[model samples]
Target chain A: MILTDLRGRYQFGFGRFMERDYDDIPGTYPLDSRTYRKGYHVNMFLMSLNDAECRDKFAEDEQAYLDTFRMTEDQKSAVLDRRFLDLLKLGANVYYAFKLISFDRQPPQVMYGQMAEPRLTFDEFQQMMIDGGRPIDGNRSVEEWKDG
Target chain B: MAKLIAGMGTSHVPGLGAAMDNGKTQEPYWKQLFEGLEPLRAWHRANTPDVNIIVYNDHATEFSLDSYSTFTVGVGENFEPADEGWGPRQVPSMSGYPDLAWHIVESAMAEEFDLAVHASMDLDHGFTVPLSIAYGQPKEWPAAVVPVCVNVIQHPLPTALRCYKLGQAIGRAVASFPEQINVGIWGTGGLSHQLGGERVGVVNPEFDQKFLDNLSRDPLANTRISHTEFMREAGCEGVEMIMWNVMRGALEDDVDEVFRLYHIPVSATAYGAIILENK
Candidate 1:
């Protein structure tokens, strides 16, 4: 079930509260320019890792791998975080990680709170994942899969 | 008196021209759709507008996601086509009418619409697709173009009402110009299809048709469409359709639909075109 296969199959909806809540506290935890740059670097790094050749290049010299981009201290920390690396190994894309870092700017509870809704809630999304024969269980939540 | 000769609205789908350029449009399914523009071709030749004020969106190509502006006006004499990974389209570079563009900018400012003006700017699919479709690959485009690239990709984009207001300002600006010239306002992008993460290639034909219908009669009805709802139904990129309201607002309520066409499933986008003539 690749994301592409879900096209035109289902209607997806997100809780409006997520954006409303985020807007209410503007700049309370805004990412400084430094953190934003690092986030972009992380994005580029993830893009690079998409290919086996690039992954092998990264494995050979991880430090040099990071040096190629201009990243800030906090961005570097977030990218180098062991937890994030685990997510990367599981096939999360750079855009996803950048979103996670953006969420990180808020409190951890707020970050996780928004995930109450599945990333792909539409039936079309589920059908695509199923057709692709990709495991959706890993991304599913106890609340989301409880009916099944 | 200078007149609003034509009102054009089109989907600025990045892949449309690329599809045609690469001979994808020759495929049976696409050929019929591409040929539908023949009527517009005939119409354009007959009217032969001297200038077009094109309103479109920038897909994080000229402007980054890091910082976004609600509205930007190109006052530069020339604009370079953006390199959107697939490389620039094989088309002649576009020259801008700075005098006209700057006049619009100044007029917009006078109307209290704070617009960002750029001396040197690169245009993405938003501007290029409509131009390519309307004028074709001419030795040079038939008329001078003033590119108005709206920031619809980033979060917190301008509201539909604001965009409509900007159109009024643009209309006023174009009318105030001392030089008499036949001008067209071309609005591009979206008849519903989204291209983005997770929800790529979504199309809502029903909504799209209804939108085009309402747009012709009551453009203000379009303002009721929320950003999230647009992203949800039309797909993330489909939100770019807001630019069409600019064209609609600038035109008289009772406009004749001179031309209309729609094509679906074109590399993850729905392609559409509409030409409205003022009564």
Candidate 2:
């Protein structure tokens, strides 16, 4: 029943709440109000890394630090595994999640590379960007692709 | 009365700050982008403004996600660089103009723009990288600064029309100040590039160029663009282009476009910059 409802919303645009509910946009996630509420604790945990003390504690013991926040087990595991895309799925704001990337001593390109559809290496992602970032032709909207 | 002399916009990508801090600006990968900044650097050197009101967004550095503000005007006398997970960048502290800042806040409030007045706030890459790009690494920043931070990170950010109106209010605020100082308004961020999701590395040059062109030729064109449209064409983060409308709205409808530059892949960003002087 839940799956049917979800598919119904996608097909008929019934469950739409805000602009973000429009599934017609391809490969885009706007940190909408719902996502903001859901990601609050996780983002708070990530935002805490801004402090030197929090950074030290988090570096010393990742699990213990993550425990300070009331995050879902999946969110915690995503952070632990450096699964950036999964963290996004679990409602991690990209700006907040960037603190985690910095803690790992990686440039943003590395994280962006990991988030790509096929999962590119940093070099591959950099090359793709130089060659002119993912073309806007078929990428703009999922609806446009269907129309084509 | 204080005069609004110039309005400018640029991408405040953190990687540009990283390159400058690590002395990589001249390296092959960074050389062209840095070289493109020479004209803007020269423009600043030739015509220095007494104060710079910079419009930038905090990326979860000083403000946490718990209770983020929609708009914040920095009214402090001094600001330190924020430590964004990593240690703070080795940059000199900045001087803030409380007198001018408070005036702007008051005037804006009088104009019915409900801006959160902040007495103290740390400067992040979003605020400082543009400074680095324009002024280089000065031991002491050349001009006093007043930071106007918008919350672009959270969803349901201020609409393009709203931000533009805020800029118009700020422009009036700066003009009403008692001092005879010259002021520069800068809106930093965006030229198409998403930082997250499977569509992370998207960059639409056509969309970005149209944005740059419309900023002067058809300033209201940008004000009419919806956030959804920005996301569709420019990428999710491309919605940041709305900030540039603030700079454009602050300027006279007709102004001199002093310098403009655009480049691709500034660390997953389509780097764009413009300097416009009020006639």
Index of the highest-lDDT prediction: 2
TM-scores for the candidates: 0.72, 0.95
Chain B TM-score list for all models: 0.95, 0.98
Instruction: Residues A1-148, candidate 1: write the lDDT tens digits.
Output: 6665554343232233223422221111112232344345555554444334555665677667767766544545545563443333233332234334322332222222222133432343424322331222222223433454
What are the per-residue Cα lDDT tens digits for candidate 1 across B1-279? 456877899887655777666767777646776788888878887887777889987653556534557788888888888654335677778888898899888989988999998888778777888887876667788887898888775556788878888888888887888888889999888877533232333467767887888787778899888875665556546678899988887787688887888766454456778999989
- Which predicted model would earn the best TM-score? 2
lDDT of 2 by residue, B39-90 (tens): 8999999888999999998888888766778899999999989898898988
DockQ for all models, in order? 0.05, 0.68
lDDT of 2: 0.88
Runs in model 1 lying further than 4 Å from the true structure = A1-18, A21-39, A42-66, A70-148
When candidate 2 is compared with the true two-chain complex, its DockQ is: 0.68
lDDT of each: 0.64, 0.88
lDDT per residue as tens, model 2, A68-143: 8999999999999999999998989788889998998998889999999879999999999888888888787777
